[model samples]
Target: MTSAVTGRRRLMGAGLGAVAAALAGCSGRSGPVPRLRLATGPQGGPYNAFGRALARAVAESGGRLEVVPVATAASVDNLRRLDEGSVDLALSMADAAEDAALGREPFARRAPVTALARVYVNYTHLLVPAAGPARSVADLAGRPLAAGAAGSGVQVLAGRLLGAAGLTGGPAPADERQLGLAESAAALRAGTVDAVFWSGGVPTPALTDLARELPLRFLPLDGYAGALRERYGPVYTAVTLPAGAYGLTGPVGTIGVGNYLLAREDVAVSPAGELLRVLFDRRRDLLREVTAGVRLEPRFAISTGAVPLHPGAAAYYRSVYG
Candidate 1:
């Protein structure tokens, strides 16, 4: 029999055991089994999908470390949880991670967070009805739209996008709704909303499924990426969503944000580094869940912009290049 199966028995144990795992891993080998809580995003999102795969990889590696994936609002929520020490690991967008680390807007205080790696790029998507009058962000004025769930990174970016387009606090600001990916798609199909803003992996599963049922018209952000980059830091970049996605005739230009696997500064070094080892080795497992083009490159993993890499993860990268 294979000994690679995963377990959550530790989570169901006594509070004493929980106290013992205050830090996920030990400095050296041999200690209480490392069990970590990973804060993933909503169910119909890439963070949750990739996070689950990582958990399985950890279990299947037959490693001493165990990870439990906790579902919540994306990026912002994940960072907050990591800050409070509620979860040992988190998945977040680079822009949001930058905000949290710098005590910027949406984050009143600096979060004690560091990156494990830059896992993937989140393609910002703005979808409208195929036959709707809203062809651009400006056209969405006074139109009802879903801007991702509250406390989510999508919402923050949505606000930023709208603000950049001069749509916020104006005479005709967008009628914004806070809904998760699945709910937003359903709203769009049902004609309850005119547009939906989602920042996720390319070929996002929920959006793809929505395209099948309801024809979608993706609006191009055009120059917003450059505009945003000037206001923000290097977190925002121009990226193209190539042709054939959602049956589009040609490519659509959009903003791209790197997604980072994050952890608290005090998280132990051993399990943190071990998690990356299992992650890169089991990269194929994530492909089963994330978008087709989503990849984990060692050099890109260390390119988390302003967010500093966790010492453990930095050591792992050093070991890799050395």
Candidate 2:
């Protein structure tokens, strides 16, 4: 594994160990700490880092719970893991979660999961070589493009963006690449691909690193938000990346979709409530580290779109907001 993945695994293992030690001395009153498995995204993506922070927070909260972070393909794969009972919680894009709840294309039947909270907004990044010929989504037609990995939420958003731009398969249909964030960045740097569609938070780690090594620009997609939402539901929204967010000169307008933290319906109410309490109580600790965690506010936390909130999550919101 890469150093980053190893680091995340070590962080989670340490958290679990701490929880186990704490629970062992608890006089057997509450029994062993409740172990909850969280399905996170690929190593280089934001979800993995954020999940590790959450696991650490829960471990330190003195609550009767232990969170284990499991790295997996994002969204589609995470939801599948939740359905299979392999994971207790997952992070997913609002659209994908809605599809799973409604028994849509990628899902064969409704999934038994409930939303814990709405997390950050993932911006659709149409990244291109600064000196390359492509100036807009239209310019990328027939050119090489990386639309994220096959099972990732980025791939779904990429298809929607390309379709909105009237580029069904674009030019050189075979040139469309389905690569992960790390692979996509390397492909762009090596001149293997002309452009890439990455739907992620502003200043994505790989993109930020790539920008330092090469000149890059984000194409505006604010115009397509309407059409995208009209077809895909209200899950799509307009979001802006301010100037200097990723060392860019000016603000870039883009389309974004909310990310939801979900849990299986069977997870107990008390542990779920404790998880949310620790999440917000230690929010600043997370914000100081992960930029994506900055969006985890209590107000936006309740906006989970069509997915219903878990009973424990609902109680947490009520106790705080009331």
Candidate 3:
């Protein structure tokens, strides 16, 4: 009888031990796990789509990544947020990154940020009404133009291009409106603005939508493309918009800059490395989610000129491409 009792006790003890082990596992005593917060651009833009795709990829990779969509002025503001440690990851333009890193132009001092990867090129789109008198950058001298938003990279580059063409601001200063791309598009369609400058990827949804509803023309920047490239070095490159890319009658020659994924200098190396690996490893899946992801290739990932690479990101690049 004692032997029978001992056998039953042992079975109960074994059951209890198994339950205790399961409870311990549920308690999550496993080491510290890092979570990432990725910052992306305004609604209905390439950055937003890309951010969502990346967040999904990270989640599937067993990493905790939260995507934060910010209604920002785009690259310039993104870089500022990165420097201030307001975000872990951000999308930025090479032009804005170069300027911020070097403490030139809009940035009063050097910013604390580094690039993870150069994802794609953004075209400098000078969209005007189909019947507008301004056919080229030079003709926009005294016209009412919306040069994107105040703190946006688009504004920075638009201002530069305008200044280069001797068209810095409207003849009557009050006539110029520095607004966000979405707002500028709306204002243009309402006939409240004569023209607007948008530096973005091809098939930008907003621009495409506008093209469908209204007759539009993209003013070719060919004349000044060489000069801009020479002045800006690798930060600016000659890009061409294929015919019908934006429903244009013909291909438009323009200057462009690469868009990169950036991060704060202090972000954890491990998580950053994991984030980059997920981005590149699942590039095809991301592209299926958004066409902009097609540009997120290994070849262009480290194409930034002088912008320091995040050590974690650099490590991943060297591992794969080295």
Per-model TM against the reference: 0.90, 0.87, 0.84
Q: Candidate 2 regions off by >4 Å?
A: 1-29, 169-174
Model 3 residue 191 distance off true place after TM-score fit, in angstroms: 1.3
**Number of the predicted model whose lDDT against the real structure is largest:** 1
lDDT of 1: 0.82
lDDT of 3 by residue, 36-55 (tens): 56667776667777887788
Root-mean-square deviation of each candidate, in angstroms? Answer: 9.2, 9.3, 14.7
Q: For model 2, give the RMSD to the true fold.
A: 9.3
* Residue-by-residue lDDT tens digits, candidate 1, 1-322: 1110111122223254343343245334586778899999888577888889899888898778899999998889999998889999999998999898888888889999888888888899999989888878899998899998987999998999999998887799999999988899989999999999999877887788888888889988857987899888778998988898888889999999888999998887778878988989987557568776677776677776666667677556555553
What is the lDDT for 116 in model 2?
A: 82
Candidate closer to the true structure by TM-score (higher is better), 1 or 3:
1
Off by over 4 Å in 1: 1-28
Best by TM-score: 1
Candidates, ranked, TM-score? 1, 2, 3
Query: TM-score of predicted model 2?
Result: 0.87
Q: How far off is residue 236 in model 3, in Å? A: 0.6
Candidate 2 clash pair list: 142-171
Please, what are the lDDT tens digits per residue for candidate 2 over residues 213-276?
9999888989999998898778999988778876889999898888888999898766777788
